[model samples]
Target: MSIATISTFVTAALVLVGIALALLVGTVGVAAYQFFSQNRRVRVARREPLVGYYRTLAFG
Candidate 1:
């Protein structure tokens, strides 16, 4: 094959690879954020009532 044809193929392959990687990273990032936020909310929900009770006992 000619040099131009080979280079064109190489360039197209690289672009496709880049797009795939970006999509993969974005999916993982969103999953991680959701996981962490869900965990955080659970922790806060479990703690909030205890905190309010303490504040009432201490200040009232």
Candidate 2:
């Protein structure tokens, strides 16, 4: 085989490997974010806060 042919094959292989690595990293990042960012707190507010009320506080 010629040097040019070998170079082309190596380039293609490297590109494929790079794409796979990028996809794997992106998937892992998204999964980690979802897992670590899980919100277990109860998000329901019983009532809305009044305009001048201090006791009633609305929160997520």
Candidate 3:
């Protein structure tokens, strides 16, 4: 094949690989954010009960 043809093929392949990598990273980032946010919400929900119990014990 000619040099120009080879160069075009290589460039196209690199662009496709870069796009795939970017999508994978974006997906992983979104999943991680969702996992952490859900964990934080659960922790916060559980804390309210513990705080109320501590207050009752301290006052009464």
Candidate 4:
């Protein structure tokens, strides 16, 4: 292949790889955020110190 064709192919490959990496990272970040938020909410919902009582059971 010519130099121009090789260069174009390399450039396209790099761009696609970069985009794929960005998407994967973004998806992971969002999933992590959601998990933490849900954990926080559950903690808040079940914050009562009393054990074996209705509040603890409700939180769980």
Q: Which candidate is the best by TM-score?
A: 1
| Model 4 residue pairs with clashes | none
Residue-by-residue lDDT tens digits, candidate 1, 1-60: 999999999999999999999999999999988866666665576675646644654697
Candidates ranked by lDDT, best first? 1, 3, 4, 2
Which wins on lDDT, candidate 3 or candidate 4? 3
Candidate 1 stretches with Cα past 4 Å from truth are 45-60
lDDT, model 2: 0.64
lDDT of 2 by residue, 1-60 (tens): 999999999999999999999999999999977753452122123243333232332231
Candidate 4 lDDT: 0.77
**Cα deviation of 7, candidate 4, in Å:** 0.5
For every candidate in turn, the CA RMSD to the true structure comes to: 9.8, 9.3, 10.2, 7.3
lDDT of every predicted structure (CA atoms): 0.80, 0.64, 0.79, 0.77
* Per-residue lDDT of candidate 3, residues 37-56 (tens digit): 66666557666564564466
Ranking by TM-score: 1, 3, 4, 2
| Model 2 TM-score relative to the real fold | 0.64
TM per candidate comes to 0.69, 0.64, 0.68, 0.67
- CA shift of 37, model 1, Å: 0.2
Poorest stretch of ten by lDDT in candidate 2: 39-48
For residues 1-60, write the lDDT of model 4, one tens digit per residue: 999999999999999999999999999999988866666655667674434443554585
Pairing residues by index, what is the TM-score of model 1?
0.69
